[model samples]
Target: MKKLSFLFIIFILIHSSVSAIDRRTEQFSTEFGYLTLPLPYVIPGAGMGLGFLGGFNNVPFGST
Candidate 1:
């Protein structure tokens, strides 16, 4: 389950392309602050609850 999700994220990053319309592409930069909050585990192995909660409050210093 975790492996599948990791692969999916990797695939997205690999295939992701940037296209700016009005030169305001900074708003679309990939951020890692709270991006991990909303993962649904289809196959629960162990400690899944704690994992999701841990992602909520981990705001980085330069999070935009």
Candidate 2:
């Protein structure tokens, strides 16, 4: 696991450095909501999950 994590980090570093990123980004973590009104497939009030558009990989060129 440690080796995998290390390699992943290295890969991300190389990839980020090789590419460019725009500074524009959404600042808030929006909660994903579904309208399950009288739906047979989905239960009422059953939250599916959070809409986590993970910005961890959104590192700019200088950040790496």
Candidate 3:
């Protein structure tokens, strides 16, 4: 679990740096943004669980 967490953090850092570069090289647009939705629920016997739905809108470079 610890190793997984560490890797996830590293991945996020690298991805953020790449995204920053992409944003810098692109034309400024008001439609670019991200959304995150959290979902929490309970089950009859399985206890509780949480989930997230996230995405970026109008990504630069015509990429979805």
Candidate 4:
């Protein structure tokens, strides 16, 4: 069961790391970006939990 849970977590990380957006017309001149990743995991005793990992780049200095 522990091994299965670990594999599942690895799968989720691998799949989510891929970006599906097309950056053909997008310009990365400004330093404004945000990324929110889903945090899901299962423990032997703690069962399952869902959380999130997020961040903002140049949020204080970069203008919208």
Candidate 5:
């Protein structure tokens, strides 16, 4: 019984700790002009990127 309880506690701790890390990619791209507004209460965290544009034609050279 003690061993089972210890294993359960360990499992819970591991799961919780693993989920604290953000597993999202660091970069993204959009083909069309758009805007992104994150939630007011949730500040954007590290390991993230953002971009804006008005239209595809206005994009600088060498960008596709």
Candidate 6:
């Protein structure tokens, strides 16, 4: 019970200290450019081609 009370006091003190800090900023910049392309359709096609090549190489009867 004593340990629990000590932990509760520590928690309250830490919580109060954290609440006292101020975090407000008013200066910022937003100038950026990026390029993105779809991959879900591209990756599966590439993976299938790679897997077919691997299977062909492993099995002598297989061909691509």
Number of the top-ranking candidate, with TM-score as the measure: 4
Report the number of the highest-lDDT candidate.
3
Off by over 4 Å in 3: 1-30, 62-64
Could you tell me the C-alpha RMSD of candidate 5 in Å? 16.3
Which run of 10 residues does model 6 get worst, by summed lDDT?
48-57
Rank candidates by lDDT, best first. 3, 4, 5, 2, 1, 6
List of clashing residue pairs for candidate 2: none
TM-score, per-candidate, Cα-based = 0.26, 0.30, 0.41, 0.44, 0.33, 0.31
* Candidate 2 local Cα displacement, residue 39, angstroms: 85
Candidate 3 residue 12 Cα shift, in angstroms, is 61
lDDT score at residue 58, model 3, on the 0-100 scale = 68
Worst 10 residues of 5 by lDDT: 51-60
**Per-residue alpha-carbon lDDT of candidate 3 for residues 1-64, written as tens digits (9 for 90 to 100):** 9999999999999998887444655485657799999989999999999999899976678655
Question: Candidate 6, overall lDDT?
Answer: 0.55
lDDT of 6 at 2: 100
Runs in model 6 lying further than 4 Å from the true structure: 20-64
Which TM-score value belongs to model 1? 0.26
Clashes of 3: 0
- Each model's lDDT comes to 0.59, 0.60, 0.84, 0.84, 0.62, 0.55
Q: 14-52, model 2: which lDDT tens digit per residue? A: 999999677686765344444433333444698454343
Question: What is the full ranking by TM-score, best candidate first?
Answer: 4, 3, 5, 6, 2, 1
Per-residue lDDT tens digits for candidate 5, residues 10-59, read: 99999998886675864454344545554334346754555443324334
Error of 4 at 29 (Å): 3.8
